[model samples]
Target: MEKLEEQIAHLTRAVDDLSDIVARQEGEIVTLNRRVHMLMQREGEREASSGGAVVLGDEKPPHY
Candidate 1:
């Protein structure tokens, strides 16, 4: 029937729209993951160079 056809067409379009959104989000997640990994590596290097000095929130730096 025509009504059934209309419903199917609408559902198909909705599914396609959702698929596009999911694909876009997947790419964004990949980019964010890479950035996080790079930041972690940079922080590790900084800590190593600083002689593993951990400046906690309640404490001040040695120069302070």
Candidate 2:
């Protein structure tokens, strides 16, 4: 029937749109994951250099 054909066409378009959205989101996730990994690596290096000490602002006198 014509109605059925129209419904099928609409459903097809909707599916295609969703597929595009999913593809774009997947690409963004990959990029973000890479960035996060790089940041974590940098943090690890920094911590290693600092000898794992938690630096709090500038060094102060023990009496202060």
* TM-score of each prediction: 0.86, 0.82
Write out the backbone clash pairs for model 2: none
Candidate 1: global Cα-lDDT?
A: 0.94
Candidate with best lDDT:
2
Superposed model 1: Cα runs more than 4 Å off: 58-64
The 0-to-1 C-alpha lDDT of every candidate, in the order given, reads 0.94, 0.94
lDDT by residue for model 1 (1-64), tens: 9999999999999999999999999999999999999999998998899897765865887898
Give one digit per residue, the lDDT tens place, for model 2 in 1-64. 9999999999999999999999999999999999999999998999899997876765686898
Return the TM-score for candidate 1, rounded to 2 decimals: 0.86
